[model samples]
Target: MKFFARIVAVLGGALIFFVGLGTAVFKSGLLGLVICLAAGAFVWWVFAQEREEYRGNIEALNRETGLNFKEAFGSGTTSMCIDETARKLALLEQGGAKHRLFGFEEIDDWELRWTEVSRNGSLSFQNVHFTFRTTQLEMPIFKVGVNSKLNGETWSQKLRLLMA
Candidate 1:
């Protein structure tokens, strides 16, 4: 499924780039090249793990959302919390399962702007920034596995499945 998603994203980016480039075949070819380059750059940035950002963070993160701090880290056993900007996330263990599950395998950015809550539901998941920030969204990487690499160092890498 994620492979299909990546294909779709690449195709969409290519379509825009080629459409812009097709215009250049008539002598605006430089602009078309630029369009394709920009699209490629954006795609790479979206999927690559900017791991340096994880430097020196807590094992048990103190997350903040539209919900306040104390409210954010409320009584949950094993749960996830996204940040206020919604660009990053952290999982919290409120004292329950001590399994080896690390974190979300998905690595792409998901943005939504159309989620509506009843405003009276139980306090569980942290509050989102907007009403729609949690609505209809998907990402490029859906499952990841930690592995020992050729260098003998363990790393978390995106899982790749081959469909016949």
Candidate 2:
């Protein structure tokens, strides 16, 4: 999972850091110091860039929709976000340049599908697909792929209750 990947990344960074530190203390001097500094700087830069990009995307989404999204899902322009206070969902497109806003009562139908898939004979993993159908206007059939079925189901249930 994501947590496992983070653990692995941290361990890898630590290993590199310690190796550089050891080399600086026992063998090489300037080269090892440079390695250690680069390793730490690379990690910091990677995390900082990711955080800024995510923040920018969320801010752009909010500006495009005029709704504050506590959590946004999906990627690029094809994102799904809910404004809990407004009881509304915003489907973004064209990199937030265009969007479809729908209230709970306006969503005629929706489905959350779970499927197992594998790549290059690797272990199979579950993918959750969330889809919505409405009669008010013409819209593309966008399938939002969630990380897990539980996440998809939880969102589906929340929408179900809101629409009810």
Candidate 3:
């Protein structure tokens, strides 16, 4: 949906640019040139604003998704965060539940935990594994993946899920 919106926006801007240019070149007034420049400026401003908004919008999405980041993976219940546990015990007990497997953070915000395995024939440089241990005893293990690139590719399981 966002992709489609972005395409439509680009096309609309292009149409405006070309129409402005056409009027400037073919019409017989200084106002036409002014209008063309104004149109170009408008498009530039819109794009610049959109560029900044893109980050905030993405962050909003991340937070929205992250609300269930822990629940999504079943690392902990919203309640009972455990009043006090040893640091090592807490880390061991919480497991990977603190991570959201489907949020934008899961897709974009991550530090790589490199493994010794890499497939020479595959573009995938790593297998992102998330293990969530929930207080619920058994919650469906939630996991998606981030690719090694910024283009937003994901792991094999995610590819299959997308296909399904």
- Which residue runs does candidate 1 get wrong by more than 4 Å? 1-7, 49-164
lDDT against the true structure, each candidate = 0.36, 0.69, 0.39
- 1 versus 3: better lDDT goes to: 3
In model 1, the clashing pairs are 24-28, 112-133, 113-132, 114-132, 115-131, 115-132
RMSD of 2: 7.4
**Residues 1-164, model 3: lDDT tens digits:** 44466557767767776777777688855766666677677668766765565435334434544421111111122111111111111111222223222222122222323234547665454554443333332342333333333322333343234323
Q: Pick the candidate with the highest lDDT.
A: 2
lDDT of 2 by residue, 1-164 (tens): 43365556667777788889989999998878987997787667656755565567667878866778655565433667778788887776543445677776677788887767778988554656778776565764556666777777787787777666
Write one digit per residue (lDDT tens) for candidate 1, span 1-164: 44466657768877877776786786688887887788877667544522122211232233212321111221223333343333333433323122122222333232222224456674322222211112124422222111112211111111111000
Query: For candidate 1, which ten residues in a row score worst on lDDT?
Result: 155-164
Candidate 3: which stretches are off by over 4 Å?
57-164
Give me the candidate number with maximum TM-score. Answer: 2
Relative to the true structure, candidate 1 reaches a TM of 0.28
